[model samples]
Target: MADGVRPMLMRLRRNGVHVGVFLLGAWAWAGGLLPGLLEQWDDIAFLGWQHVELVALSGGAAILVGVPLGILFTRPRFRRAGDIALQVLNVGATIPTLAVLALSMGLLGIGNGSAIFALFVASLLPIVANTMAGLRAVPPPLLEAARGMGLSTRHTLFQVELPNSLFVIYTGIRTALAINVGTVPLAFLIGGGGLGELIFTGIALNELGIMLAGAIPTALLAVLVDFIMAQLQFWTIPRGVNPLR
Candidate 1:
């Protein structure tokens, strides 16, 4: 009981820290602690919207592609190839994100489309890796029992395996989302029109306040999204299935 209580308390403290950082940043922006930031509030808000939109679109794409591929790779016939697939994904992961964006720009031309594509690629590995791990983690006995009950493959996948794997799958998605949020700021390099615009512009003009205006919100947005994902993970995962919970 003490061990469990300690972890719960640690999680609560971590959540408190996330909220506190967000609030502090918000207060600083609203109270004019940074002289130039208030003047660019409209621009900041617009870029924030763009930043979130890019993340959502790219993340959705990653989920759509990654989840199904993960499921497919876990099949008996494809299991042998899964290692090769993961190695290829690891290569993707290891490449610099900016390089991906640059390559995408060459193919797609500059703008949101290229940015979204790059981010989708960047986000895919975690989702796929997590999905494979989660599916594999489903207990062998549970699967045998499903077979004993004469459940169809599709039925067993949907009713037993997927449900049991939800927490792990969500963990992967949460990681991908966090990566997407952090990476969005680089989108401005390709005319992707996100908070990166402000940050890079501030760097060019040597304006600290302008940079802070963009930087603060980007960090806060990442934290906020992560916190929300944590809540979703807690609520969506089945009771007793989430060992940490």
Candidate 2:
């Protein structure tokens, strides 16, 4: 317990420093941060909420679909197909995020639908990949032991395989969410409506304050999301499998 606490404490201290530096930098660059933030407070709040919604919708869908698909891929019946699918997903992941958004916009005809679909595609590969990897990484000895105890396939999967692999699976989720937060800004292009409105608008008008309005919040949001996910990871992952423990 002390061991885990120490690491968490150290991490918090580091995060504190990062927050401080970020604020100091913002203050220096923008000068009188309050006026700028307050100037567009209404837009910032509204757009920020939109940004969160985009991430939640896309990231949630990825987890729901990716986890099951990954589990299916690992099964003997679907292993070959899974391998091919994973290869395809890997190829898909390599395509630029903007291109994915453009493709979705082309198909979905713009709006939140296109943005969500694009973000979902970008977020899926890691979850599926990690789920498969984690399941396969279960030690052979454990399988033999479970079999010796006459555990059924379903029992082995739920009681044994998933528990062991949960840590890796969580890591994948964290990665996917981070990607979602970062990529969400692009959704504005497809009329998805997010913080990107301020950012791009600021750019167009050459207003540092406006750009920082969006950029700063987005950066803070990314950090906050990652932090929340980290806490979830610590609490939910089984202690035996949890590296932090």
Candidate 3:
């Protein structure tokens, strides 16, 4: 396994996933999968795309906020109160999601704003904790050597600590993205929009087509996100790091 071949294989695999998804989507649409799903045909085309967009919007925002906080909290200075930091983060994780949505209703006035906020909170803990963990997990000797070289704190973080610890951070994000897939459905409760609407509408009207329609897309979205994260993890890890060994 030469380094050169590894990247080529990864690229091929990446393309393979896209090919698989396209094939599956076509099969689902053509094989009456939508009809067998749940039933909201009043606007099937629009809603399908919207559900995917909702997942991306909510999850994407979580990454933007969570990654920075993760990077910030990884420093040694931040570790002293890691307990406090974790406790604050835990509060976000522990609060019943519905309560957060309810609170957001009063605070943000509903719609996507409120839903994104809740999803953001839900996705925060794993990433923040993992970032700090990754930073801490860096070999102490490495840190000492970097400091000995007169590397400034910022320089040390970016140049030395960040790269070595990135594996952990990526793992954290992958975990958070998985969590987001399930949690984003809560948005439907708030009228913020998502595939959950299909789940709800199906149960209410006993329409299998709509339910499958919604479920398939949400499931596909989760798998797609997971695949992307996996590729990222593999690509970013140093040439020889075993992804699963």
For each of the candidates, the C-alpha root-mean-square deviation to the true structure, in angstroms, is 4.5, 4.2, 5.8
- Candidate 2 off by > 4 Å: 1-30
User: Total backbone clashes of model 2?
Assistant: 0
The order of the candidates by TM-score, greatest first, is 2, 1, 3
Tens digit of per-residue lDDT, candidate 2, span 129-218: 999999999999999999999999999999899999998999999999999998998999999999999999999999988998999999
Model 3 regions lying over 4 Å from their true place: 1-44, 240-245
Error of 2 at 208 (Å): 0.7
lDDT of 2: 0.93
As for candidate 1, its clashing pairs are none
Model 2, residue 144: what's the lDDT?
94
lDDT of each: 0.91, 0.93, 0.78
- Candidate 1 overall Cα lDDT vs. reference? 0.91
C-alpha displacement of 38 in model 3, angstroms? 11
Report the C-alpha displacement of residue 87, candidate 1, in angstroms. Answer: 1.6
